[model samples]
Structure formats: C-alpha cells, structure tokens
Target: MKAVYINELGGTDVLTHGDRPEPEISPGEVLLRVHASALNHLDLNLRASNCRRFPHILGCDLAGEVVQISPDAGTDLKVGDRVLVDNRVKCGGINLCEHCASGNDQWCARQQRIGVDRDGGHADYVVAPAINAYTIPDAMPFTEAAALPIAAHTAWHCLITQAQLQPWDDVLVQAAGSGVGSMGIQIAKMMGCRVITTAGSDWKLDEAKKLGADAVINYRETASISQAVREMTDGKGVDVVFDCVGADVWEENMLCLKPQGRLVITGVTSGSRSSIDLSILQGRPLHLIGSGGRSRRSMADVMKMVNQGALHGIVGRTFPMAGVAEAHQAMHDRDFFGKLVIEH
Candidate 1:
C-alpha cells in the first residue's frame, strides 16, 4: 500500500509518500480501500509533534469502499460498500464505557483519534472499527464525502449542538473561507437564520455568499468587525457568533454579539492566548463556549444531514496522494476556502 506518512515530527520535508505494508484488521474492524481523504489543521499539528506511532498516516477525513470485515465485527457492512470513517474510536460496542452508556461518549476517557493516536487515512488502505464507519449515499462522490468527517462535523457540533442556533437568530460566522466556517454558514442558513460571515479576501467572501451568507465582510479591510455586524443587524448585533479563528478576533467576536448571545469557538488558527475583560461578561451576560470533545452521535447527526441533502461537503481543492506534501503547504498558506482532499 502507498501512503503519506511521517517518521519524525517536522515540516513538510518529513512527509514521505511511499509503500508500506497493508494494514490487517482485527476483530470488530473493517479494512477499507481508500478512495479519498481530506486534510485538516490537525494533520499539520500532528505532523509537527511527537506521534504514538512512527510512519504515522496523516489524514483525518476518509471515504472508501469496504474490502474486508472481521468475522466478529457483527456489522451490517459488506464488501464494496461505500463508507466514511468517524475518526473517533472506543465510543461504542457491547461493553459501553460509563460515558457511552450515558450518551456522553464524547467524554469517554479511553477514546483515541485515528489520525492522531493511530494510523489514519491518506493511503490506499486503512482499517477502522466497523462502528466508526458510516455508509455514504451512492450518489456522493468520494472527494466530497472525504471532506465531511472533520470539517462538517466540527461545524455542526459548534453551531447546532453547542451554540443551539435558532431560525430567527442573526448569526455571525468568523473566517468564512475556512472549512468549518463555510459549513457553519450552510447549517445556519438551512435553519432559516440570517448569516453574516467574514473572510480576509474578497473572493472568499464572494464564495461565502454562494453558501447562503446574508452578508460578507472583508475583515482585513474592515475598520471594526463589530460595527459592521451591528450595521447589518440594525444595530442589534448577531444572536450567535461562530468562530474558528481565535485570540486575534476574540474581542471582536464578543463585540459582534447581542446581549445574551452565544459565541462558540472550535479552532485557534491564529495564536490562542488572550485575556477577556471580566466586566464585559458581567455586563452582557453572554455565552462563551469552548468546543471540547466531539462525539460519534454528533458525527452521526452530521451524516443524517448529508444524506438528506440538507448539507454538503465543501471541497476547495483536490490533490493526488503523492502530492500530500504540496497539500500540507497549501493548508499552511491558508490558500483554500474549504477542504483540501487527497485522492488515492
């Protein structure tokens, strides 16, 4: 099997695309012939840090065909079935953990991440617990399905689950050019909410409009994000602010929200360190949420939306598996509006 992996933590120079032994599935697992995988910031972060395993495969979102299943897997899946992996392990099975039993599996202490803790997609083949693999619609392209697991799931978790967005709310989505940011706009719009989004470039803002953003702001050119958002909302501010960029826009996020408005953050693409004025929280009584563990249940909810055609994956660009290094560079450059996929 050919894969993009790292033997040491460093820059893209350490990303090696070559042949590796095909992974063998254990009990309760299934082997997949990977068709496509999508890149995430987590891939870059793991590529630069120590890994639990060497030659670590670096893709978090995968869509593929089932080739083999362990006899004890006890799954309805069969060979040739198309599926997308959930990436989170130890969330289900007969012996449910305390968290899983209570439907709070996101907090399962023994949970492991595929691209981070174990080998992941980004290769011609990968293996995952059958429970983590969900069948995708036959009409969905592999590249599009590959773009959904992390980006769409995270966005769904932040906006729908965490923020509890309402149809009548005016929403603010920060960094509209990002994968989660773009998905957030769609989710908000699907619920009949008015979406206001921001990006650093005009072209990206234009794309955001296509995704149902009611208003777009070029944050790079804007003198004040809060002031612009207020103007769009008749000086009332948005009822919810969904942010992926952190610290640099933290203060602005607070200012863009209405009193008792909710703000949910899932990423820190910029620097993460920042101090909040306690007085502001007291004065406004706002909801400041930090995106914590994501669960299989939420991932399943996202897939429901995808299957119903209410939501779709946003693929900004696609690269052949061999070009994994170039994909990493593009992610670092932040040149794409949505996911950067690697086709096997």
Candidate 2:
C-alpha cells in the first residue's frame, strides 16, 4: 500500500510518500480501501511536533470501502460496504469500557485518536475498529463523506449538545473560514439562531454570509471583535460564542458574550496560553465549556442532516494523496475555506 507518512515530525519535508505494508485487521476491526481523506489542523499539529511513533500516517477524516472485516467484528457491514470512519478510537478498540458502554467514548481513559496516536487514513489502505465505521448514504461522494466526521461532528457537539443553542439566541463563531467555523455557522443557522461570524478577509466574510451568517466581522480590519459583536446586536452581545481560535481571541470571546452567556471551545489553533480576569468572569457568571470529540450518537445525528440535505459539506480544495505536503502548506497559509481533502 502507498502511504504518506513521517519518519519524524517536523515540517512538510518530513512527509514521506512511499510504499508501506498493508494493515492487518484484528478482532472487531475492518480493513478499508481508503478513497478519500480530509485534512484537519490536527494533522498539521502532529506533523510539527514529535510523535509517539515514527512512520506515522496523519489523517482522521476518511471515507472508504470495506475490503475485509474480522469474523467477530459484531457489525452488520460486509466486505463491499462503503463507510466513513468516526476517527475517535476508544478503549484501544475494545469498546467495552465504562465510557464506551455509556456512549461517552471520547472520555475513555485509553482513548487514542486515529491520526494522533496511531496510523491514519492518508494511505491507500487503513484499518479501523468496526464500531467506528458507519455506512454512508448511497448518493454521497467519498470526498464529501470524508469531510464530515471531525468538523461537522465537533460543531454538532459544541452547538447542540454543549451550548443547547436556542432558536432565538444570537451566536458568534470565530474564524469563519475554518472547517469547524464554517460548519458551526451552517448548524447554528439551521437551528434558527442568528449567526455572527468572523473572518480575516472580505471575500471570506461574504462566503460566510452565503452560509447563513447574519452578520460578518473582518477581524483584521476591526480593532475589537467584541465591540463589533455588541454593535451588531445593538449592545446586547451574543447568547453564545463558539471560539476555536485560542489565546489570540480569548479575551475578545469573553467580552462578546451576553451576561450569563455560554462559550464553547474546541480548538486552540492560536497559542493556548492566556490569562483570564477573575473579576469579569465572576461579574457576568459566564459558562465556559471545553469540548472534545463528539459521541457516535451525535455523529449519526449530524450525518442524518447531511443525508437530508439540511446540512451541506464545504470542501474548499482537494489534493491527491501524494500531495499531502502541499495540503499542509495550504492549511498553514489559510488560503482556503472549509475543509481540504486528500483523494486516494
């Protein structure tokens, strides 16, 4: 099998595209012929830092056809089934731990992500636990299916599960050009919330508005995003603020929320270190939530939306599997909006 892997994590130069042994399936596992894989910031982060193992393949969002499955895999899927991987590996793929049994696999003590802790889908072939594979709609393209798992699921978890966004609520999404940000905007709007989003460029802002953002802010041109949010809402601020950009927008996020409002955070693309003002927090009594991977149930719900055409996949660019290095460069440059996919 041909794969894009790294001998040691550092930069794009470390990414090696070459032949590797095909993965062998274990009990409750399935070997897939990867057709498409989407790139996420997680891939870039893992590539820039040292990994637990060398020759690591970095990608989580995968859509592929099942070529082999363990006899005791306990799934209804068969050899020719087309599926999308959930990316959140749990209990070392055992799926019998307390967290797994309770539908909170993301909290499992032995939780290991597909791309971060193990070899992932940036290859012609990959293996994943059967439980993490879900059959895709027959009409869906592999590239679109590959773009949904991480970004859409994360947005679903943050907006619906964590924040419990209401129809009347006004929401603010940071970095509208990002995968999660773009998905968040669409989800919030679908739920009947008025969405306010931020992007660095005017064209990106216009794109965000097309995705249903009621108001758009160009952070590069604006001095203070929080003030802009207040002005947009007529001094009331937003009921919820979804922030993936970290320390760089931390303070502004706090100020953009209405009193007693909720703020859900998923990623720290910008540096994570930031100081908080205890006085402001206590005065407003805000809710600050840290969200991680979504539950399988949540992923299923979001996928249902995709299948019904209520939610759409936003793919900004596509690169061949061998061009994984160039994909990383595009992500770092922030040259595209929505998700970037690697076709195998």
Candidate 3:
C-alpha cells in the first residue's frame, strides 16, 4: 500500500509518498479502501517523532467503503458499506481510563486517540475497530464524508460536551479559518450561540460569516484580541472561548473569557511557551478546559448530523495522495479557509 509517512522529525521533506506494506488487521477490525482523507495539524506533530515507521497512514478522518471485514467478528454489517471513521478511541467508549484501552486491544489509561497515535486513513487502506465507524447516508460522497471525523468530532467535544455551550451565549473561536474553526462556527451557531471568530485575513472572516459567525476579526488588524472580543460581546466578554492557536495567543484567549466563563483548548499549533497570570483565576473565575476529541457517543451524534445534512465539512482544496508534501506547505501557509483533502 502506498502512503505518506515521516522518516524523521523535521521539515516537510521527510514526508515521503510511496508504497509500504499493507496493515496487519486483527480480529473484529474493518479494513477500509480509503477513498478520501483530510489533513490536520496533527500530521505535522506526528512527523516530529523522527520514527522510521511513525505513521503507517497519515489521517484520522476518513470516508470510504468496507472492502473487507474479519469474518471472525459477529455479523452486524457487510462489505461495500459506506462509512466514516470516528477518530476517538478510548476504553468503555466514554469517560473511562483512556490510556488503559486506547488505540488497540488495550485501552488508553489516559484516553488517547487513533489516527493521532495509530495507523490512519492517509493511504489507500486503513484498519480500525468496527466500533469506531458510523454509516453515512447512501447518497453521501466519499469526498464529503472524508472531511468530517477529526474537526467535527473535536468541535463537538469542545462546544458541546466539555463547554456545554448554551443557546444565545457568546463564543469566541480563534483561528476561525482552520478546518476545526470552520466547523466550530457552525457548531456554535447550531447550539444557538452568537459566535465571534478570528482569522488571519478579511476574506476568511467573510467565509466565517457565511458559515454563521456573528462577528469576525482579522487578528492581524486588531492588535488587541481580548479587547476586540470584549467589544464584540458588548464589553461583557463571551460565555465560551475555543482556542486552537496556542502559545502565541494563549494569554489573549484567557483574557477574552468572561467572568465565570469557560475556555476550552485543543491544539497548540504555535509554540507552547506562554505566560499566564494566576490573579485572573481568582478575580474572574474563568473555567480553563483542556479537551480532546469526541467520545464514541459524541462522535456518533455528530455523524448523525452529517447524515441528516445538518453538518458539513469545509473543504477548500483537494490534493492527490502523492502530494502530501505540498499539502503540508499549504497548512503552514495557513491561508486556506477550510480543509485540504487528500484523495486516494
């Protein structure tokens, strides 16, 4: 099987596209003929490992067909079924000791992830536990279904499960142009929150608005993020703040939260070193949350929305599997408004 993998932790040059051995599937596993996959910032982080066989495949989110299923598994479905993968993999499917049973036969006692830790969908084939997949509508296209897993799941986890965002609450979503950010806008709107988003450019802010952001900010234009957020919320700050742009914007994310408001964090795309003030913890009583992907239940719920046409993955560019390096460059450029999809 041909796939993209990091030979070492370094520049995009280390990501080579070529043939590798097919995955060795175990009992109860479903082997998918990957039709399409999307890129995420995790792809770059995985390459930092400098491992020879770091990622057998490169994506967490995938949509394709069930080419083969282990017969050893009990009957539930059959071959050729259209599906999308649930990127989250933890013990008991929810709120369990994740690391003890994550990513494999064993669980993650710490509740880890699948595509971020195991072989993923960035190839012609991938193997996952059957429990991690959901059926898409028969009318859904692999290209569209391919885009949902990670971003959608992560968004659902932050905006729904963790933050418990309420209707009419104000929200501030950083990096509004990102794949996660794009879905985040919709998720907040769907939850009835008046969302404010920050992108690097004016055009992306427009795209954010089209996706349902009530207010958009070009972070480059606004020197003070917290102040802009305060202005957007009528100086009261927001009920929730979802931040993925780490380190460089960490302090600002904290400053934007309202008194007793919650701030949920996932990725730290920028450098992770940042300063914080403890006084704000006591003064404002902000809820700082560190969140991972959705639970199996939440992933399924989000997928249900996709199947019902209530949710859509934002894909701005498509690249062939062979051009994984080019895709990395685009992600670094950080200009695209949605996701960069890789077709098999």
Candidate 4:
C-alpha cells in the first residue's frame, strides 16, 4: 500500500510519501479501505517524532468501508460496511491497568493513537480494532465524518464531562477560530449557553458568530476581553471559560471567569508560560479542568450529533497529501481557521 511514513523526524521534510507493505491485521481487527482522512495540529508534533514511534503514518480522523474482517476473533463486522475510525486505543484488562479497569480507554496506561503511536489512515488502507470502527449513517458524508473524532470529541469532553456545562450558562471560549474552538462554541450553544469567543481578528470572529457565538472579540483590538465579559454579565464574569491557547491568555481567562466558575483546557497552542497574579484565583475561587478525548460512548454521541446535522463541519481548506509541508507550515503560522485537512 502507498502511504506517508516518517523514517526519521525533525522537520516537514521528514514526512516522506512512499510505499510500504500493507499492515497485518491482528485478532479482532478489520482492514479499512479509507475513503477520507483529516489532519490536526497533533500531526505536526507526531511528525517531529517527539512523542511517538518512527516510520509512522501520521493521521487519525478517517471514514472508510470495511473490506475484510477477522473471522476467528471478531463478531459481526463485514465487508463494505461504511464506518468512521475511532482513534483512542486502549491497553490492558481488569486490574492490569487502572485506566482501562475504570473504563477510560483513552487514558489506559499504554495507549496508542491510530496515527501517532501506530500506523494511521493517510493511505489507501489501514487496520483498526473492529471495536474502534463505527458505522456511519449513509446520509452522512465521509469527509465530515472523518473530521469529528478529535475536535468534536474534545469539545464534548470539555463542556459536557469536564466543566459540567449547564444550560443557560454564560461561557467564554478562547481560540474561537480553532477547529475545537469552532465546534466548542456550537456545543456550548447546543447546551443552551450564551457563548462568547475571542480571537485575533474580526474575520475569525465572523466565523465564530456563525457557529453560534453570541459575542466575538477581535482580541488583537480590544487588548482586554475580561472587561467586555464583565460588562456583558453586569460586572460578573461568565460561568465557564474554555481555553486551549494556554499562557498567552491565562490572565485574561482568569479575569473573565465569574466567582466559582470553571476553565477547561485541552492544549497549549501558544508558548506555555506567562505571568499570572495569584490574587485573581484567590478573589474569585476559580476551578480549572484539563481534558482530552473521551471514551467511545462520548465520541459516538458527538459524531451522532454531526450525522444528524446538529453540528456542521467547519473545514477551512483541503490540501492534497503531497502538500504536507505547506499544511504543516500553515498550521505553525496560524494561517487557517477551523480544521485544515490533508486529503488522500
């Protein structure tokens, strides 16, 4: 099979597109003829080989059809059934691993990402555990289905599980132009919360508003959105703040939260350290929640929402697989809003 794989890691040049032997399917695993695959910022980090194995194919979000199933080990998956690949891989059983015994597969003591720690879907075919492949509704497009496993699931983990977001709550979402932030705004609104978002320009803010953000800030202009949030809430800040931009916005996020409110973080896109006056937390009694992808049930629930048209896929552009370098540079330079994909 022809696929993109990295033999050594350093820069984009390391992401070489070439042929490799087809992967051997294991017990309870099925072969997937991937129709579409999407890229995320994680691809860049994995490409550098900073955290995962070498000679790895870097991609995870995918939609495809089952071509072959392991008859001896699996139950009922068959050839030609349309499916969406779930990226969260688990290890261990029973008391062997605390994470798995608790049913949090994504946090298993030794888990592998579909495209990070293992071979991914940036190819004509890939193998996934039958349990990780989901049947996508015929009405849903493969492209959109491939986009949901990460950002959408991350948003679900944040607003629903982590922050325990409630209806009619006023919530602030940082990095509104980001793929997760784009979906984050929509998820908050779906829960009936009034949404406020902050980004670098009105252009990104416009997209944020269309995604149901009640208010959008051109962060480059205002210099301080905490005041805006306070004013909007009658001198009280919002109930929850969803932030992934990390240190660059920590202080503002601190000021933007209402007393006893929560802030859920999933990543540190900007430089990791920034000064914060500890007094803000002392005064307001804030709570911070850090989250990542969720369990299979949670991922499936969010994807079902997308399959039903409740949440729309916000793809900024689709670049060919050969344009891997450009895509990586664009993500690093912050050149696009929403999900930037590398299509096979």
Would you estimate the TM-scores of all the predictions? 0.98, 0.96, 0.90, 0.94
List residue ranges in candidate 4 displaced over 4 A: 49-52, 72-76, 92-96
Best by lDDT: 1
Q: How big is the positional error of residue 107 in model 3, measured in Å on the Cα after superposition?
A: 8.0
lDDT of 4 by residue, 200-270 (tens): 87888888888888987888888578998888788989999998888888888889987889989887888
Question: The CA-based lDDT of model 3 is what?
Answer: 0.80
Supply the TM-score for candidate 1: 0.98
* Model 1 CA lDDT for position 46: 86
Top TM-score model? 1
Lowest summed lDDT window (length 10), candidate 4: 88-97
lDDT winner between candidates 2 and 4 = 2
lDDT of 3 by residue, 1-344 (tens): 88876656788787778887888667767888889888888777676662345544567778888888877755376898998887665554334563434533233455445566677787888887787768888887787787788888888888898899899789999988888888889999988889999988899998888998888888888889999988877788988989888898888887898888899988888877877877777688888898843456677689878888889878888889888889889988887978888988
Backbone clash total for model 2 is 0
Q: Name the regions of candidate 2 deviating beyond 4 angstroms.
A: 92-95
Residue 303 displacement (Å), model 3: 1.2
Candidate 2 local lDDT, 193-255, one digit each (tens): 999999999999999999999999999999999999999999989999998999999988999
- Candidate 3 lDDT score at position 178: 86
Q: Return the lDDT, model 1, position 135.
A: 93
